[model samples]
Target: MATVIHPTAIVEPGAQLGADCEIMAYAVVTKHCVLGDRVAVHPFAVIGGDPQYLKFDRASATGVTVGAGTVLREHVTINRSIYPGKATAIGENCFFMSGSHAAHDCEVGNHVVLANAALLAGHVGVGDHTFFGGGAAVHQFCRIGESVMVAGHASITRDVPHFTMVAERDDVIGFNAVGLRRRGFARAAIAELKTAFHEVYFTPGNIRDVAAARRAAGAFDSAEAKRFLDFFAGGKRGFARARRAEAEAGE
Candidate 1:
């Protein structure tokens, strides 16, 4: 299929668009941008805009790359990286709702969904199959694990673990059981994840010590459990935890 660019849209010279791309009215695909096959840029969306950094050079040769089958809705803005040869990357089959923003140097993974007005700060790394609720905001340099669900209006300043569901208050409520089910995770795997979740997040001892002990004991039975344990090892901003008061209330 041929690429389609509306007469009203401005695709700057040096932008590389693959087959079947659709650029709608008033959308801008700036120079150095690369859009893969079937990518859609809706009206008023802006791709490959300059980085919003004080130290960024205007002459930098950085760019943005959107993988195949992604959709950027109306009013969405995705900024390019700051340094030469770098890029702000969005993976295949992702969806960015209207008004969503991906700041400079973000690494978004495949099948991720960013709802309307969701914002990702510079250098954020989001894993595959994650869901960001409407108005959710992730702080710079944060890492969000795969299959996680962030509730609407949440402010995420730390790393979120895989298969978790975070509430609006930045608390990890529990595993994303429904998402796991929908994704066809085996029942036994889900059960193992549940047990590991309780041990890592809700154990009585010092959280770090408990996690270490569990790791040392070879207590994790599944690959998913091991992955969960590995996540805590590199938590620079720490991990999101259950709010004790809130959990008590819910119980």
Candidate 2:
């Protein structure tokens, strides 16, 4: 299938668009962008714009790469990276809703969804299959884990572990059990994850230390549980902590 660009849309010289991409009216794909097959840029969306850094060089040769089957809805903005030869990358089949923004050098993974007005700050790393609720905002350099659910308008300033649901300002409320079930995770795997989650979050110790000790002990058998424990290895920002009172309230 051929790529389609509305007459009013601007695909600047040197922009590379793959087959079946549809750039809607007034959308802009700058020369710094490389859009993959079947990517859709809705009306007024902007891709591959310059990084928002104040001290940045305007002549930098950075880029933005949108993976295949991604969709950028109206007014969504994806900025190019600041470092030369680097890119603000979005993985395959991701969706950025209207007014969502991905700042420069973000590494967004496959099947992620950023709801309307959600904002990802520069250098943030998002794992695959995550969902950010509308108006949610993540601080720069935070690493959000896969299959996590961030509630609407939440302010996240730290790393979020896999399979968790966060809400109300950096609170890891509970496991995203419903999401795990929908994703076809085995019941046994889910059970292991739940156990690991309790040990890592509810334990009476430092978050990283608890996770490391549990991982070192070979306590968890399932890969999912290990992955959850392994996420505590290294990060600049601390991991989001579970709010025990809130967690128990729902139980």
Candidate 3:
């Protein structure tokens, strides 16, 4: 299938458009951008724009790579990376709703959904199959885990664990129970995650310490639980916490 670019769309020289890509009216695909097969860039959407950072050099060799079948809605903007030899990448089959933005150097995994006006700050890492509600805002460099659901307008400042639901105050409110069910996760798997959440996140102590104790006690019984444990162990932004009596007591 031939790629279609509307007459009003500006696909600059050196931009790579894969087979069957549809670049709509007034959309801009910058010179360094690469769009994979069947990508639909809606009207007024902009891809591979210059980084917003002050220190970024315009002459630096960097761009955006949008994976196959991704849809960029109207007015959505995905910026290129800030450094040379880098690219801000969006994974395959993701749906970016209108007015959403993914900032420079961010890496978003496949099948993620960013609702209208959801925003990800620079260098944020998002895992697969996560859903960000409308107007939810992630702080710069935060890591969001897979299968997570961020509630609308929530403020996320720290790393969110897999299959978790983040709501008010950026707290890890609970497991993404409805999402898990909708995704056909086994009943046992969902139960295991709930137990892990209580032990690792809701325990009235230092979350890491509680996670360690659960590991020592073999409290994590399933492979899903093990992955949950590993996420916290390797997390960079640290885990999001709710108001806990133990933490307040120590303070």
TM-score of each: 0.94, 0.98, 0.92
Please give, for residues 1-251, the per-residue lDDT of candidate 2 as tens digits.
68999999999999999999999999999999999999999999999998899999989999999999999999999999999989999999999999999999999999999999999999999999999999999999999999999999999999999999999888998888889999999999999998898899999989999999999999989999999999999798998988887765532
> Which prediction has the highest lDDT against the true structure?
2
In model 3, where do residues sit more than 4 Å from their true spots?
216-218, 243-251
Which one wins by lDDT: 2 or 3? Answer: 2
lDDT of each: 0.89, 0.95, 0.88
User: Which runs in model 1 stand beyond 4 Å of their true positions?
Assistant: 205-209, 244-251
Colliding pairs, model 2: none
What's the residue-level lDDT of 156 in candidate 2? 99
Error of 1 at 157 (Å): 1.1
Highest TM-score model number: 2
What are the RMSD figures for all models against the true structure?
A: 1.9, 1.0, 3.8
Model 1 CA RMSD to the hidden true structure, in angstroms: 1.9
Worst 10 residues of 3 by lDDT: 242-251
For model 3, residues 114-179, the per-residue Cα lDDT tens digits are 999999999999999999999999999898998998889999999988888887667777677788
